[model samples]
Target: MLAAEKSKKTRHVLGISGGKDSAALAIYLKQQGRVPEMEYFFADTGVELPEVYSFVEKLESWLGQPIVRLGSGKDFYHHLEMHEGMLPQATRRWCTQEMKLKPLEKFIGDDEAITYIGIRADEFRDGYLSLKSNVKPCYPFITDGLVRRDIFDILRSTVGIPEYYEWRSRSGCFFCFFQRRDEWVGLSERHPELFQKAMEIEEGVNRRFSNLKKPYTWVRGMSLKELIADAEAIKEKSALRKAREKDPRSWQEILISDRQDDENQACLVCSL
Candidate 1:
């Protein structure tokens, strides 16, 4: 048992990533009366969507506990400057390392801790496993055989899924590079200010990295400005894709299945 290997004081930690899976894990553990002393935390990047913040607040209420908010003390722009204005991409994710993982590691310090991750049974991807011997990663969802549907059910019965799910599938910074083309359009429509900021950042990166083989952008082969210019087409394509996948399945189920196709293309620490 987990308790058997416990040190004199082993911290039980669960990270809330402002995504459905982590939020559902928190609720699931509470319902199971497991890890009553779990320390819930959110590693804020300071640039997440307003909807993500709102969802976290709602989730805290449902858990009936104050979710500790941790940060690296520096914002995204600071990290961007430190990286010579280069935007973080899938291959190079300094953003997740500096803004998310480092803060989490600092919070845990050298203390022995069990970090509960929310990667579901259906997901073939692995969570961020720290090399620090003091920190151990745990996956209750997989152990209990809970999948995507079970995550949705937990949220629906408790705090409900994040509002951003109506448009974006995952949660992270508003300027996250993992955003789909349709999600970028959704950002432009729902949070124009944030979208503008993202565009400005992309433009700044492109200016600094002008010597690169291609222009740096949030979306590959295209800039946010260019993406927004083709918003109608993107929307039409997204709608058609949804129509093609539409059937007797619930919207949540459809989204879950569609997201699985690109499961390997995400930052586990930020998305899960």
Candidate 2:
């Protein structure tokens, strides 16, 4: 209805994954008046960090627009059934397909939509998302030639980034298997219950796949139990490594660095 008959009015949609980049993008879009009526959404995996919710609330106030949350109503258990009890690994990421992408596709429906992505110019990964012909993907940050420093500056000038950055580098599901070894420790200490749930998922699934001895557990080599047991050593080493970076220090910066140091890339929408 917003666009004319021949024009095929495109729906302007921006997703806020409760991460700093997406939040900053929301602010940039509104402040720049790129699309005053841009629709914002957060695809909820239903197990995100509490700080994410609080951060989104702050962004909503700043953007003066509702960030509609599209949730997987059935949660992980429902999708797990569909995947036949096999836990999603990095190689076969069924979880992202079912929980993240499916919900988003449902929201757009048949509308001619412009999906704004927040892949910054400083980024090294390629998502290559969006297969829908009607849902054209656009990268505002990349097109604007805004890099990591620019994103940092925008977030700094605005809501100052989510507090979760103090602990975790990325934002997504609390039980996101992509979390670092030290982040698991942070999770256990900060949000014990959520950490417990994540560990249970690993333990239960590993037990089921014990016959094959699949090594695709949450972290690389160690189990959650082992990771927690070695938390002190890991945290101390992390502290030492972080002391070397000249930038302003935080657990988040350390985590981000750790993510880059390792070859593992976080999901675009989930981590922003």
Candidate 3:
């Protein structure tokens, strides 16, 4: 097995999701000089946040190498039409498969690639975005026992957190369905253009799906239109909740402490 695995043409590669963990992982690998020819790539969905693009540019400068940007041949609209206008949710993440992971697999071909996954020791979930057996995942952070603190330190010590963190918590497409209700409002305030585009996508989905045998929307329980309809109330409620939490850090601290109970973890390809 060792000989066969060794004979399988190894490729050292890392994927940058434009998130802190991936960015930090790139820095960590460079500092350690583990894989000098490590191929860094970022799969672009075209619908990604501008902040993501800007952050990637900064990270590229720091690493002194251009991180390859892999994009879906077909735009999001094309894919949405192909999937009968279904917006990808947590359960149906075709977007990741088609837009992100597939491009990565194509880049690697049949070569056995040691895919350096950026998942920290603090996160205990598996990613479903990649299914290439030749592309094996290696968690250096876990091996080194690095945690969230280490990841934050890497960002602070390097290019700094992506500006989007001021509003949205995760990085991916601007209209990523994984977003919380508050994140949608954050979009409205921070990047109204992107939010409008997202609203259009939602509208398209609603129109396309309403004609189908079943109905679907980007968000569960409410369409973007409905969400926007009650945007004022939602914002007020969110503000009240924030006030109820007493303060920002205290609220986050409580949530973090509560979420460490093994069930609150997310397994998406990016947030790792």
Candidate 4:
């Protein structure tokens, strides 16, 4: 073919994980006039929080460019069934592998590209690293020594932090296994229908795999029903904890502050 001798052009891409840092990175790149042609994208899990979608829309409008939404042809439910009723957990994080990374890889294909990651300088973790030789991961925040405050600054100067942060700690699926008990309570209070859906998934898996060597729930050791049964007590403990804090931040601010470092770090692609 006539085009066989031509080299493929490189592309610039940024993945927005519906969290403050990634959103800030997109804004930071734009502000610096660094990569005007950068292709921004989000790997939609289909069951993402409504606020996540709303934040994505706001970010797209601010950038004046569409953040392409990629997904596997199948939904999370289908994947759960394929996994033989094994609910995704921290150890078995196939959800991220399939729902997030696979779609991104499919989008990039054989193209040589720099995929910008948003890991802050203060965080001692590397974000997602794709095995594809042609796709290189770049940590802009790390290179620039940008920390959490810098992320806040960038967001404040642009589309602002996601509204979901008001309740949940980080961004990802609504029923993300990484969520804390308090966040689950927040979800149940904020969006009962979504919470019920998550509960159903947990209950369904447990029932289908009754003989699973290691039975699992979205929250380990506690079923959603049990969590709900004790929601008031959890809330009371959260209130007491907040009351002891000397930070004078509002209740929501305090909760978010306490939540930021609440869990072991999640996959960057899902929560960065």
TM-score, ranked from best to worst: 4, 1, 2, 3
Residue pairs with clashing backbones, model 1:
none
After superposition, the stretches of candidate 2 with alpha carbons farther than 4 Å from their true spots are: 1-8, 244-264
lDDT of 2 by residue, 1-272 (tens): 43457346678888888886778788888889989769999888877898888888899888877889887788888887688777776787887788788888888877889988877776666543678888888888988998766776788788886777777767888877778877788899999999888788888877777786554467777778888889999999887876775557565444434435231276676767
Candidate with maximal lDDT: 1
Residue-level lDDT for 225 in candidate 3: 76
Error of 2 at 54 (Å): 1.5
lDDT of 4 by residue, 130-227 (tens): 88899898888988998776677677667876777776788889999888899999999999999999999988887887887766889988989999
lDDT of candidate 3 at residue 209, scale 0 to 100 = 57
Error of 4 at 225 (Å): 0.4
Instruction: Give lDDT per model, in order.
Output: 0.87, 0.78, 0.78, 0.85
lDDT of 1 by residue, 157-183 (tens): 899878787788778999888889999
Report the number of the highest-TM-score candidate.
4
Backbone atom clashes (below 3 Å) for every candidate: 0, 0, 0, 0
Q: For model 4, what is the alpha-carbon lDDT of residue 192? A: 97
lDDT by residue (tens digit), candidate 3, 34-95: 88989899888888888999999999999999899988788988887787677888788888
